[model samples]
Target: MMKIKRKSLFTVFLLSMFILSIVPMSAENVEIYSMEKLLDMYIENSHDIEIMELEYELTELKYQIESDDLDNKERQMTRDKDDFYDTKDNSSSQKNIDEKRDEYYASAKAYAASTKDLMIQEFEIKNQDKYVANDTAKKKNSFKNDLWQLYELDKQLEVLNATSDLYKSKYEVAQLSYSLENMTESDLNQALIDYEQMVLNSDTLINNLDMLKGNVYINLGIEPEGEPQFDIVPPQSISPVNITYNDLLSSHKSNSLDYEKQSYSLEAEKVYFDILAGVFLENSDDYQENLNNYKKVQLDFYNYEKELDQMVLDVYYNYQKTIDDYNYAKDTVELAQRQYNEAETAFEVGQISALDMDGAKLQLLNAELTYDQSLISCAKATDEIALLMDGISIK
Candidate 1:
């Protein structure tokens, strides 16, 4: 009986140890997304990343083919050189030596070009890695901006609802006054029209909000129980870290995936051109044709570099205008706030109708919404330039 009791205690101890060891493995899944987690998912699962992976694999296969070809050519050249030494016919022996020497030189050049091709592929893989990282960051930042705008739409809906309610209530009062002959027929008709317009506007806004919410859900790859809520912290300032155009151009030129791809194309052309030039006379049609093609490719690459510089320039100027707009929107918000306060005072003192005060409130809401939009625009532009220049996620 003592042995049985000890066995039971040992069993319990073993079970307890197993449970403690595996507890962390049973952790719950995350239901809410932070920006960092979202960026991680995008980087891992994006179609562009998948495509880059496939391209890298294809490049490796091509490199292997070239390497194998070079190895086989070296073996053939070795056989020809041995035969050249062994052959009894003098002319035949000299011809064999010259042919083997030409093959050896050509094979050496081919191997060198293939080695550079592998290096180009390695560089491409790194550039593509940066591209995926930058693109994921850009997408996440855009999603955040959309979320902010979605939240603002919630406020806009509330304003529309309030306006609709006030209009309906006022129209009811105006209808009674018209029945008692205290209001003109035209005034009552106008009240009905205003109430009808408010209802129509409310319906339209609700539809729009539904569509926008769907857009957010589609981008996030998640289903929401109801309208999803965002926890947005207002920006302390809309301005981004200072970046000069020269600094931007330098980073972009060195790190740009597009530019790097173009560079690799130009390098590949040069490799092929070198091979062709080695086999043909400079005056031959094939050599001249290839030389012209090489020149054209070099020109195109040069032009594309300038275009990339201009792209950076454009992003900077656009960001500047967005900041200006944000500043202007702030001034408009303050003006609207003052006007609403004055209108509220006028309504309280019986100097303006309730409808007039509601109009002022609507104006304030619109100004605030516009100001919010400008802030988001400024933030998005800043994020875009950062993606182009730094390739780092916002979080």
Candidate 2:
């Protein structure tokens, strides 16, 4: 007889699944959903985001109407000034012309700024959509992880129950042998120890299961109407998309609302300068301040593009790392599966202890869980890339 040291069941608590440990419960047995469908559900009834969308729409409309009104006023002022000079005050028409030009320039600047603000509001609305989509992606990723753990743990617990049942049988046999003076005291004590260890491991698995149930509910965002039923299918193969990282970065640059907003800002600033060119004194503080603001906006726009470029590069490298990690995890699962097949055969032939068989099952379970975890990581990478590219789907 050999004494086997018990391994730590607590190690499972340190995995990615634990990120879901603190969430509130949601509705039970929700049908399985993809990343796209989950985002749709979150957007449909999400009041917090709805408010943001509405605010952006209202602001856009308000600013657009104001800008149009200002444009009309500037045009009308020129017309009125022209008619006044042509009909009534021809002698002092030059003064009227300069005054009206100044007024028109001021109105043009106001219209330009207000139009830029409308573009900003449109960008804000797009950002609101991105926020809703990104949060949904993260929560779904978390739920996917929790489900994978639950699946592996559920299998592990089932196998562990068998081990416990066998241990109990051995303990009973040991007790009878001790009563009959056929087994040593040390042997009986070891049997009892094995039985207790199996029981404790079972208890640990059950507690972890309960913790996962609560987290799944919270990620889904609905109160548990009843016992939540999870129907998760882990990935079997890596899905490859027909695009490259440069393609992704290029798409991101093209669709970026931030860039669009910056363009509008720069355009409006140019109009502001054009309007102020004849109106402002060359050496005045107001002229210098306006010039500085233009330069600052230009610099800020360039800095933003630099930041975006860096972000795209970083994400691409990380995505590659996740791909490598997933392949390694997949290989680990294959090795664990082979070991488990051997252990299972040995157990069936009565050549191995129930504890040894259970240990093999646990190893396989852990490997499967790791494989699923890598899949989740890949999913997150895909989601982040999609977010950056503004709706480019990654397989």
Candidate 3:
């Protein structure tokens, strides 16, 4: 019996060591950063932002190309006028005729230049407006809001970690109690089991924190080892516009890039339809093939417009849902905290069981989790709104 008891005690010692192994060595040493810093870090590191800037550069190049095309058209008209007069009868080479050709060419060139310049200027202005309207200022405020959420989650995790430590300490105490003949085998067994479970929970929390860090790194385009920092620059405030949602929708109907692209596509399609109706058909099969291609471009334009409308509606609805969820989660956390305080007090006064205390603690933990999730959702919703408004910063 003495040998059997020794073996049992040895087994418990080994189990205790295994449980202790789950305790994170670096938990207390890990650096915690504020949300503003995180956001700044993300932006600095984000590849997606770089890609968007590249796309903007490409669009600028395309505008320049179109401008050049207009210039070339004017140059060709000038050349045509010279050719026409050089071949005309010298007797009829009236200076008035030459003046008329010059005037006509000048007017055509001016009109083309004006239209091209207007388009290019409009595009540049819109690009600048997108950068200006982007809520970089609000981003810091949003980060502040997210910071509160992270703090809450951190606090909850801290509690769980502390609770795990408490369980381990209690298990040690139970072993001592057993040695002193004050604790039964059943009590010791239960304490050991609880300690093991708490260790698992602590490990899970650490894993979750690590995962969050990974996601932040991915979003910011930073390596995992990069030190994250944020600069809090205040945004230049703007006067509030009195435009309603309907007004915005109306303005966007024509001004949105997606809409504009669709309109251009539709116009191209109409040209194709004309070609397909044999309006420009020569005897050549090559010309007929070109006409067919134009028709296909038109069909694609209609499909694109339909897709864009659906996308706009989807984004709007998602933004609304995110706002609602954030409000609900915020309110729920307040209530959960209140309830937890009451339960803790009741438990301390012996008015509630340990199970009831645990339940309250779990409820508060869940609330904190939900609140953090809501903050993320709200940030994403804000991004969506910016995207819809074409107000996303290039880089």
Q: TM-score winner among the candidates?
A: 1
What TM value does model 3 have? 0.49
- Candidate 1: pairs in clash: none
Off by over 4 Å in 2: 1-40, 68-112, 118-223, 346-352, 387-395
Better model by TM-score: candidate 1 vs candidate 3: 1
Judged by lDDT relative to the true structure, which candidate is superior, 1 or 3? 1
lDDT of 2 by residue, 135-157 (tens): 54444444444555665666567
Off by over 4 Å in 3: 1-208, 211-255, 265-292, 390-395
Q: What lDDT score goes with residue 36 in model 1?
A: 49
How do all the candidates rank in terms of lDDT, highest first? 1, 2, 3
Instruction: Report the C-alpha lDDT of model 1 over 265-308, residue by residue, as the tens digit.
Output: 78887876776576545797756877898899899988987777
For model 1, the superposed segments whose C-alpha errors exceed 4 Å read 1-33, 41-55, 70-119, 126-128, 155-205, 218-221, 226-236, 391-395
lDDT of each: 0.65, 0.63, 0.53
| Candidate 1: C-alpha lDDT | 0.65
Ranking by TM-score: 1, 2, 3
